[model samples]
Target: MTDKLLNHRAEGSTTAPPLLLGPSLGTSTVLWDTVAPELSATHRVVRWDLPGHGGSAADLIGPGATVGDLAVLVLALADALGIERFAYAGVSLGGAVGLHLAVHHPERVSALAAICSSAHFGGSQPWEKRAALVRREGLAGLAESANSRWFTPGFTVPELVADHRDADPGAYAACCDALAAFDLRDRLPDITVPTLLVAGREDPATPPAHLREIADAVPGSALVEIPGASHLAPAQCPQAVLIALRAHFSGGAKHGMEVRRQVLGDVHVDRAQARQTPFTARFQDFISRYAWGEIWTDPTLTRRERSMITLTALVAHGHYDELAMHVRAARRNGLTPEEIGAVLLQTAVYCGVPAANSAFATAQRVLAEEAEGTGG
Candidate 1:
């Protein structure tokens, strides 16, 4: 543990789980401005400036630096803030720092999201050239092209361009040197924490294929490609990045179980878990993470609305066995008996009377059981 080496801003309650947001090279903490504030509602977010960018001291790293050096600095900042462990998300070079942490310091990271980043950054020859260019002529030329490199055509963030232009030439060049040396392709399999890779569909820097490669190698890791986004996705399309981050860091199996119990009741979920076997373990996980965790937990639709949609879908598909179970779930989601009937009745026209008739019988039986359970 060391004193903070990076300039950073912390938000959210001290009791909340900490989440560190990292920035791309030549950009400052401003790169995270659009997303961090909202993320702080649930996470104690600490977005830091890279060496020589924003408020961090330009002397933090010199020429020939490595991403490991940056990782250590990030750890120092975490220690200074009294954060023993945290979830991590970053863009580009910042994302690379997160991958490094997950590989070398797994205990420190709870989860990870790498956006518009890569496993090796295309072998580093280009980075070496960029380093030489920055050291010789400064960042003016690069800053002028920042918009083209960091975003899609006609989309730009003036502050980020200025950050690039204003970054210390020596330090920026040193970061480029670090990029030249970074290559984590071999270590990708060693990452055990839940990982997520978000790619910009139009990004010329780290394209979707780069993130896909990571997804295929890191066990259980997921990938999300944002259409119409470029290199700096958080700035260009913060909502998509936020959704991905929230889902990735949403506690996975544990949170899924919580939502599962809430929707289906404790008895059902407990019985399901108690019956889980080695052969059925993966299926159980898929239900929890995919159905309960991802779909059921999405806030876009209220649980009541979801119940209605679910009941209708179940009837339409003739899943009467499952429909009986969800009829109870619909009640738990606050749908009255009549409301559930209405949904099933709507299915009569669309799903045919045969399917709706069976659905009605199942719903009636489940409702009777519920009535008996509570003296209704």
Candidate 2:
């Protein structure tokens, strides 16, 4: 059943981890144009069109087709692409599909970001009405109102409107039917993948509260709200959406290496790597894989926040040698000299003046040396 119900476009290097992107029911891969390219720089991004939308065929969708059926089509697409395990991010209906994958095929999904979507799309009556209207009047029946729901006022993208207008009425109606029967609220806790829920502040369709419900249900899931955007937040607020997605998807060893070098400086990282001996090789690998790759690369907190936290902890624990190295890293992560001083001052009261005093002296020496190196 998966021969061609979905139309897929793959980008990025073959060696990179596969990241599957799903578009909203009425939209196509164009929905991810702004976000996918940037993510492709680190991940192999594969964006696909929903059946009957964009270049995909509507023949697979029949009367009373369920979201599960749509989810199966996505799995088939992944199978066809030879993707065994991958990360997923989807918008609206696309997000619902990702949720389905995480719940049903947990082994296949590494992480998920469900943007402007909900576990259950309210009651079925509204969806039934939409399905009937589109089925009776064709795609033209819902084009204007649908497009309006997609974006905030004065932020329309003509390409998105065109994509909505060009959708096949039958397929769109089938998707509406899929949405009507979709109810994953009770199953939310079953989703074990590291998940992120994103909402647009102004989205009336699936409001922030809708996404919040899912976020509350899914354990260990995080929620992010985008300001000044509507249901199609990815298109309306690409940068914010991209930042959230990158943080979720960029936790691999390769990306961790890049981020580690960026924060710690290439020279310092290279020196540490060069110092790795057979006896210390395993410890180096562990820190690189766990600390830098997994924890440090997380996007939920900025590098600056991590830097400040790392410096404070070092001073509190009297880890002066590591503290000195991190002082240099903190500077690279945008912590000003004044900010570093303030951290030490605050630590002085809680961790003892002696500890803070030594930290200050070490920080001063590192800062002065850096100043001389940079001709400051």
Candidate 3:
């Protein structure tokens, strides 16, 4: 693998799963600075600069390099880092690299988030003209225009513009050539990894419509449009982009199962599975698919928040049995006994004293049983 990639481990832990990041052509890994730190809390972030940008050498991109060729370099980088499988997020040309990897090397990708990118970057003539212009006059000829395309008004990052200016023109031209020949529309259906496509509503470079085409073609892929962003949505609107990436990477059926087990405990989940008869199998699947898969797996709220909400709702509805179950879940989600009591007490004001009283009784019994079992 080319030693061009930069790796940053999350500050608190080294055990998090790896996440590879790619930048748009002419930009360096610095393009991801806004979101990478937040993502690093849950992932070991590995970001790479395009050839000729940042630390990567211009000579590394040989003549006529294709997007597939860049995909190979990414896989090589992963292999070098001993990452057998990883989540990936990229922007523009970087997103194109992600598509190539997801399509051709499916086993290596755990999940994918493509921002302001397309399966096909439209007709080749524009790319050809850009490549020719860069080759003749260098990136200086196109830097201002390219920077303008990347962000909506008042959202530009000076560093990102500098990245474009610093890039080797020959390498940038080669990337343009790559974009010219890249087309993977037919291969979208073959991707099985959970995928997210983010588009900027104002992006003149790769508009929301471009991402919509890929989303429709890729089975189960989700598309999101950031309202006022342009090409560099991740940089311009980091919070929105981070939310989408976090959900895509960490919210899914498998993740839902993990969250379910964590909330309900392994014993409860195993017992529920064991009690499933053919007649009840569909019910179990429904809970797993909808309740856990759809609701519990939402990344917008933490498990603790959901637990508190669930407990309150159950008490308000006078669902004592469910309230009892969720009382145990609330404890598992790190809710303290005092906090549980507070939720029950609050229910009295909104849901009536009788409902809170019954909920209190049920929760007290469950909490006692839990305390006794653990000798706490």
- In terms of TM-score, the best-performing candidate is 1
lDDT of each prediction vs. the true structure?
0.90, 0.88, 0.84
**TM-score of each candidate?**
0.72, 0.70, 0.70
Best candidate according to lDDT: 1
Error of 2 at 7 (Å): 0.5
Give lDDT tens digits, candidate 1, residues 53-166.
999888899888999999999999999889999999989999999999999999999999999998888877999999998889999999999999999999999999999999
- Clashing pairs in model 2, backbone N/Cα/C closer than 3 A: none
| All-Cα superposition RMSD per candidate | 10.7, 13.4, 10.9
Give per-residue CA lDDT, model 3, range 12-40, as digits (tens): 14577789899998788778888898877
Clashes of each: 0, 0, 0
Model 2 segments beyond 4 Å from truth?
252-376
Q: After superposition, how far is residue 283 of candidate 2 from its true place, in Å?
A: 28
Candidate 1 local Cα displacement, residue 150, angstroms: 0.6
Sliding window of 10 residues with minimal summed lDDT for model 3: 5-14
Tell me the tens digit of each residue's lDDT in model 2 across 271-347.
98899898986577557656888689778999889999999899999999889889989988899999999989989
